[model samples]
Target: MRLILASTSPYRRELLARLDLPFETLSPQVDETAIPGEAPPETARRLAAAKAAAVARREPDAWVIGSDQVAELDGAALGKPGGREAAVGQLSAMSARAVRFATAVTLQRDEERFHALDSTLVRFRPLSLEEISRYVDAEKPFDCAGSFKSEGLGIALFDAIESRDPTALIGLPLIAVAGLLRKAGFALP
Candidate 1:
């Protein structure tokens, strides 16, 4: 079966590649905007489905995988920082706090659909302004929600990570992805 990833994120691309499956990627070009009343998990779900549908429209015969991640702190959704100061602030606000990352994925082909949601809780260690500054300057994770990359230097900022699927924290839940793909008749050993 043909496989396609409906995203341009290098992180997601790398995570998907771990399956050792030949796949192609297309820029979903999805607007990552949250609705005023939508819950963080819901927003992730909506966006993931939208991404898959967008690409599925172009290649109806291919199995399209779409995924989205949203970070939630104290009941509010946190978006990508987009810059240095914003990243620092985000980290500061999250210091010694447990942040929830909702990663949602959807697989679509013709009329068949499969979906998965994984919520990972990351407890951040107490951080000083200097440490936050140093980390931000070194990693520059402005493009990631919650301003930290779990797979890289950002892991130093976390006291604990609680999740059924560790890869979900990085942006794609491979466990869930594998299950959904298997359900769709894709072979994996």
Candidate 2:
């Protein structure tokens, strides 16, 4: 069966490429707005499923994979920064705190559907404004949730990371994705 990734994120695309499976990418075009009183995990899961379903509407014959990540701090969800000011503010607010990254993945094909969620805990070190400013300037992670990229120089901002799948912090959860794909009859060595 043909495989399709329903996301435009480079990080997710790179991670999916590691599976060595030939797949095409299509923009999901799903609204990512969080629902009122919704938990971070649920938001991620819902978005993931929505993305897959959006693309599946166009390609019912292909297996579509959709994924999303949300950074939760103090029971609130922190989305992408989208600019230097927002990135700095997000980093500052998250300094010396533990943030839970809820990454969800969904696979859909015709009547079949599979789903998974990976939660990664990242503890940020106490960061001064200068440090946050420098990191923001160097990495420009404005488009990334949590205002940092755990796979890049942003790793230095964390004091500790606890996760079952390290790649989940980057965006896509490979371990969970592999399991879902395997259950869908895809062979993976």
Candidate 3:
């Protein structure tokens, strides 16, 4: 079966590659703005489906994978920091706190769909301003939600993480993705 990933994120692409499947990648190019008052998990689910649907419209025969993640602190969503100052601020606010990361994934083929949502709790250790700055300077996680990369130096800032799938924190959940693909009739060991 023809397969496609409805996003251009390198992280997602890398995670999918671990499945050892031949697939094509496309930019979903959908607006990612969260609906006002929408919960974090809802935002993730909506965006993931939107991304898959957007690409499925173009390639009706191919199964497309779409995924999105939203980091929630105090009930509000945290977005990609986008710059140094914002990264620093986000890390500071999250210091000594437990943040929830809601990640959603969708598999779409025409009108048919399968979905999964993974929730991860990241407990950030109490951090000093100096530590935040040093980490931000070292990792510059400007493109990641929650202002850190769990796969990289950002792991140092966390006291603990609780998740069914560790890959969810990196932007894709492999276990969920594998299950969705298998349900969609793809072969996996």
What RMSD, rounded to one decimal, does every model reach?
A: 0.7, 0.6, 0.5
TM-score against truth, every candidate? 0.98, 0.99, 0.99
Off by over 4 Å in 1: none
Q: What is the lDDT of candidate 2?
A: 0.95
* Model 2 ranges with Cα > 4 A deviation: none
How high a TM-score does candidate 3 get? 0.99
**Quick one: ranking by lDDT, best first?**
3, 2, 1
lDDT of 2 by residue, 1-189 (tens): 799999999999999999999999999999999999999999999999999999999999999999999999999999999999999999999999999999999999976899999999999999999999999999999999999988889999999999999999989999999999999999999
Which run of 10 residues does model 3 get worst, by summed lDDT? 6-15
Predictions in order: lDDT = 0.95, 0.95, 0.97
The digit string of per-residue lDDT tens for model 1 on 30-72 reads: 8888999899999999999999999999999999999999999
- Model 3, position 57, has a per-residue lDDT of 98
